[model samples]
Target: MSSAEVVLDLVRSRPPTLGEGRLLCIDGPAGSGKTTLASQVASAGGDAVVVHMDDLYEGWGGLAEVGAQLGTLLLPLAVGSSGSYRRWDWRLDGWAETVTIAPSSLLVLEGVGSGVSLFAALTTVLAWVEVPPELRLERGVARDGPGVAEHWAQWTHDEQAVFVRERTRERADVVLDGRVP
Candidate 1:
């Protein structure tokens, strides 16, 4: 089976760490398959709510800060309470809009800092997706286009610090080899 299918099966079998719904995190370096895998899991998860770290980051240097804010926004949701967070709009270069999380049976948070230690307690399963640096960069540039590509390296560097400090990959419940199929 494909990696995505494997992850879906895992999600299906694991119980939620919080209230009725499970909180899942799909985290990895830029260009890794986190987003894609999260998308697939969400599709299979039935009533899944997805929160992209891309929308959470303030900019290229916002990994740590954004990660700190995730829990405040999500913890309330654990008990089926409504919660909301303002999403960072890359184009407008500011906090563009608020994203409200309605209670769902499953929640998927995907991005570089999605699995940070601070939010560990809120997560039901933390997945670390990895691809070779070269392949990841190629895919990231291709998907985002040249404009965002210019900032990729800088973003990666910032992400590295959080990954190390939090030991995100080491603490993962599922580690996915996201190399090209």
Candidate 2:
């Protein structure tokens, strides 16, 4: 069965959080279909909004800072009211556009460490998408190309740190097998 199917079924079986103020976190490594799955979920989730944490980063160097702010400030605003932000463009490393999260929305934070400890209290469900390292590397290399070999090495370190601190996997309400784990 498709991973999305499993996730959809799992989510459907649970009480729908539609029209409720809650957060559902989809945490996983890069290229693990977090965005796609979250999109599928929020589409069916009544009054839901998908929030990409990647947009919170400030030129890839402010992940922790952005994450902290999201957990502490923006998420609460998003739960009941509209939230707004001026996002940083990764490629350009500059302010791009002002993004907004609406009230009574089902916000999906699809990025590694998104559902970290900071968000635990507000998160109603936590989903972890497990993708083996070899397969993950293969997919990553394919997308970023051989030119990113060094970058990947550094990313592995960053990922490890994030997971170590966040522990999003162990706290998962469900595990999503993306054909690799």
Best by lDDT: 1
Per-residue lDDT over 85-178 for candidate 1, one digit per residue giving the tens place of the 0 to 100 score: 7888887888887888887888888888888787778788888999889998889888989887778878888889888888989999878888
Across residues 61-160, which tens digit of lDDT does each residue of candidate 2 receive?
Answer: 5655536547433554644656676777877868798776665545566777777786566666788986788877887788768876676666667767
What TM-score does each of the candidates earn? 0.93, 0.80
Q: Residue 9 lDDT in model 1? A: 73
Estimate every model's Cα lDDT from 0 to 1.
Answer: 0.81, 0.68
List of clashing residue pairs for candidate 2: 48-106, 49-106
Predict model 2's lDDT versus the native: 0.68
The Cα RMSD of model 2 versus the native structure comes to 3.1
120 Cα displacement, candidate 1 (Å): 1.0
